[model samples]
Target: MKKALILSTLALLISGQVAAKTWVLTDTESNTEQGNWHISSHQLNIKSSPFSIEQTVLHGGKQEGSKLLVIKSQNGLTITLIPTRGMDILRVEGFGVRMGWDSPVKEVVNPAYMNLESRNGLGWLEGFNEMMVRCGYEWTGHPGMADGQLYTLHGKAGNTPASKVEVSVSDSAPYTITVRGLLKESTFKKADLQTQTELQYVPGSSQFSIHDVLTNKGDYDHDYQIIYHSNFGQPILEEGAQFLAPIAQISPFNDYAKKGLSTWQTYAGPTKGFDEMVFNIAPLSGANHQTLAAVVNKAGNKGAAIHFNTTQLPVLTLWKNTDTLKQGYVTGIEPGTSYAYPVSIEREQKRVKQLAPGQSAHFDLTYQLLHSASDVNQIKQDIATIQGDKKVEEISTPMAKE
Candidate 1:
């Protein structure tokens, strides 16, 4: 009987059928089966075969007072999501390649400190250092007041806290893990905005997906603007980094961008006193309403790409700030429902979208990190074909409207 039992144990170990150990740490909320996790040395680990999801809360230093969710796949993809910070993605690394930039702000601050009244209320800029930050239901660009009310830079969505956060790991085929949260941006006697967000990571793939739903719970029509502020920094945004997109129309936001429009596809080493440039682009439609954009390093060995629905997000903004190598050197590939203009200007141009009471809009975006030469080459070929087709045009800048 002892020999039979030993053989059965070995078979279970070989098949990986042995139940995984789980650990959980919480202060107020009760843990559920979906939240089954293993905590060791203050790390929350949820194992599902080859993929594991780890949860860690910041205690001290710059990361102090923040809660982060780390997802790891057997294929070497690692993603960190911060639930306390509007559920923004903090970092993405795969195959020894760092895919996001580092912000000068060393510490994560509570969303309560997001001030739009200090120095033009650019406090949001300090915490803007992340892989992806969702901007807006009212305004998203410069700070301005409309109808006797003031709107801060980039709105308040990024600073709003999320509730009902849930994490789940699946053991089925094509194993997957998901982190879901709900962010509500509402005030008494003001507009009501709710955003439901979900981040999904699958094993054996270098790509993940973000699904969001924005709804207006007010009684009247309300202006709405949302942008996926996706930023990429070094080693992906180096001196020779290349930007690729199927741009059908491009418009320079300022004279500086107009002067360098011809070489906008290339990048230069950071220079002192470098003026930032902004370009608004309308992507060419693809099969099933999809659009593509990417940034690849000079060596073309590492890069990141995005696939989004042009029908949902009709505009893309490319922000280049190459001021100094040590600081203020980053690029943003943003997709939004409207241009990154002031709220008044957007209204004047009739570009702002309106959500009626009880109406909701859904946005879906997929991000992929390219770790192999083949993946990078594929994007290059797509860009080449887009340029060769010669279906692109240049539009007048917003200043021209003045």
Candidate 2:
């Protein structure tokens, strides 16, 4: 009996059946999985399913930090972080999503930003596919005091002292994520302090975690921009893709400016012939914030879906292809930390959230991907089911701590 028990325990450890395995995926090219997917740690690894190739950056190389996972869908959709030099360029070669980076707009110059905070590298949530905050941008081009890339995510840091980020993958699912960070100081100034954002991987459910501790190390109080950049490209947004939002009017960044000027004006109809589409969403109404849908259809085969969250975020930014623009290559269904202005402008517009010396603010949002819908109403019903009647509380869980 003792021998049997010992052998059973040993078997469990070797087979990794009781717990997930943290296999460092590196140096592998794209390939399909007969059953399970592969993970490696070598510089540039590509994992290919029968239908798609998922490439990750072990080395962003020659350029600064382009460290992001690249996905190439079976329908010929591809995505990669643009090099630092192309910071302002949002591109779509085919049916793909290109997340662009713009230099951070200085708050001091604009009086509208008296009590605002500023950071380098796209403001708000411009880095990834989704912005997990109220109003924010994707990527900013500024380097931090330390060598790491500085970014702001959703949620509040408050009195916490430690923070961390983790990401995991399952044999069947695409990705899982979670984040935690410490709030060491009450006053955080973007220019003064240096910080390190670490990535943690563990054996458990195939989920990713990201966490940070934002501090008000600065002398005065300021409202910081909190956003998450969630970028989905290619196969995710194909030719027949559709997006939904609670929008009565669509506006440009600058309505009366040049055609390509970062304008914000009410959108009367579908946006056509433009580089990208960025819109300002209205305030939250009950459970509906906004929804962006995308669909790709070739012949009769169709893949469609919608993306959005609840009250935590109140704006939506959509990008599609016009006659002069590349249609299906990229479509950004972005949620943000603030509307399209500096933090100061947000404050003037009564859109900024204040953070005192010892005070903190908590923000929450969620995103769900859909597979099929009977029609527009059915699709709306599907979203209603996911965003049904639950509020996301900002608290610590086992998934977040790991």
Candidate 3:
């Protein structure tokens, strides 16, 4: 099956439509294609059609009018982009594997229908179905009353909408598909933040890269925090699945997590009341401070890897929620500047970022979709090289309040 899927990917590369064109899907400033915009291979004007970008709106329920972009690449890769939900990546297909989960919340939900402050600040879970979702601009972590403000689980970023969206293909070889969006978090008399995120991937490759430039549009220097909640489930996560990383320091987020410290790097089958466990890790890196982390299936033949740099995102949070699939069985390989506790604790720990007026922060990360044993094994070897004789610091006690 793996060989056949790989061959199909190669065939897609060999037989794809190549074109150099830019489409303005949505531009609030220029007054361009803004409402329920869509295009197909026929309208794209590309010969033989190696790829196509299409946008459409979902109907009914909480997903009403949710805008989704389905981008198909030349390497037989396809990804669904949600503009209505902070421009998150919904799902991935091809590449000898399927990257998605059976989230009970089946809607590409629009933010208009979600009450982020409901359910005692845990309302973000109402539409939490994406594969990758950014978790902050002001603050993230769990929800709590801190500094006289009620901070919600994660933050407003995932539930926020992008102000603008665009798609373009490279003019030359590689023909990288770039999906760009601008997400803003602002309110009256508060911190005003915006991030221009570009998700780019070559047509014939099994990986994609994210470039984000977050700027404080407000005059005041206010605190901000962001965590990339990259999640996986099903085929890549199961009983006996392994979480691999080059660790510099590791500790449990709470006492419950500490109880499983011995098997922290391992996963289990879904149990009815398993609930969740979280681990905080300071990862080791190679030259240029590059870090890698991944989770492979029980057989170790398939996996997904997150490539990042410690310079921008220095903290890693492993979230194990291997409960029943009906209750959203999944794992989050999160990278952030701070651990997820509460906003007050993050501020006290100095993990929250403060940007000066006109100052911006840059972040770069790549998602490599691994399919075969060779690819998965290669990543394991690369991680081992990064560890390179370093002693890992393991903590037995709880590191923070959860």
Candidate 4:
């Protein structure tokens, strides 16, 4: 009986049916799965799936002291997550394609070294190379002064380090890996907020997902905003690439954004001194209030899509910066609670969300990769279905409020 039991255990191990594993890389109160955050560097060699995940601390450049978690799957997926920057994704690579832009900023900038108030409130651009990054727990619009207070470019959520990070794997099939990061924003007399961001991946799939829960812990009600700045460039975003979305209402952000209104959904290769343009879009939702936005390459054989629910994120902003490669060429398909406008404007427009004391809100998004023409076409069809029978309202200029 003992010999048979030993053989059964060996068979389970060989088939990759071992028990689940959990690791706490920075939990402050837990002891069993906790790690010493004070330590400069360490490795957590997680190997329960068909792939691997490694944890290490960077030591050079603005990214110094940043904690980078790299995941590699047998399905050719590579994801880099930075816990030091509110669990923002650094880059994603798979199927001979990359999911990030070529920014002038070469290395990742540690949040501790970033000054969000510098350069006349444009300091947030210093550490803006991530493929996906959160924009706020308070504000995410342009820098301005309101109610005798100065608001910086974007809020502090993306620049705040996570107080706790934990990794766990499912014991069931597919063996998904879940990485959770906790970020807190608080002050003595100001608002108190906490955001728990979870990034999950199936080792052998060409997709990943983000789940975020934000809670207001202040004594009174508080208004907040959030934006998921999902940027893309290079191979998947080129000269003739197209932006597909179920647009119910669309308007140019400013006079400059109207220059390319004729080909708003089309892209240019690269130009010298090409200024950026933005389009404020209200997306149409299908069943269950779900929507999809995509960018397919010129050849229509490769693409990427962002799947989100319009209930939580009611607006989408499309940003195009087809500048020269050296000057950083990219585009952003941003889903957010409000448009990138001043808090006062959004409030007047009734787009700002208010949370009662101790209330929480949830946001979810998924990133998918398409490697074939059929896959890309399927997304286009899905978007078209959402647009059925709805007349698109295209404004020739900015609204009177702007």
Using lDDT, give the best candidate's number. 3
Off by over 4 Å in 2: 1-219, 227-240, 256-273, 283-310, 321-328, 342-344, 374-378, 382-402
State every prediction's TM-score relative to the real structure: 0.86, 0.45, 0.92, 0.90
lDDT of 1 by residue, 223-278 (tens): 88988989888888889888988888888886768876777788887878888888
Alpha carbon lDDT of each predicted model: 0.73, 0.31, 0.83, 0.81
Better of 2 and 4 by lDDT: 4
Q: On residues 1-402, what C-alpha lDDT tens digit does candidate 4 reach at each position?
A: 122223323333433454656778876556332322321111334344467777877789888888788877867578998888879998899988788888998877888889888887789989888898898878888777787886777688888888888877656655666788999988788889999898777776667777899999898998899989888999898999999999999898888888777788999998888999888999999877888898889999988888888998989999999999988889999999977777777778888898899899999787877777887888888888889989888887864244
Q: Which ranking of candidates, highest lDDT first?
A: 3, 4, 1, 2
The better candidate by TM-score, 1 or 4, is 4
Give candidate 3's whole-model lDDT.
0.83
Per-residue lDDT of model 2, residues 1-402, tens digit only: 112223323433343333332332221133311122323422222244222223232333222222233323343333221211111112222222232212222111111211222444333222322212122212121123223533323212211112221223323222221112222223333422212222222222111122223334445555555444343444444344445443434444433222422222122122354455444444223323434333333221223333434344555445443222233234445555555443334555665554555444433322222222333355455444443464422211111100
Instruction: Give the Cα error of residue 147 in candidate 4, in Å.
Output: 2.2
- Regions of candidate 1 where Cα sits further than 4 Å from its true position: 1-49, 61-64, 383-388, 399-402
Residue 18 displacement in candidate 4 (angstroms): 12
lDDT of 3 by residue, 104-173 (tens): 9998889999988999999999999999999997889999998788999999988887888988775545
Residue 274 lDDT in candidate 2: 48
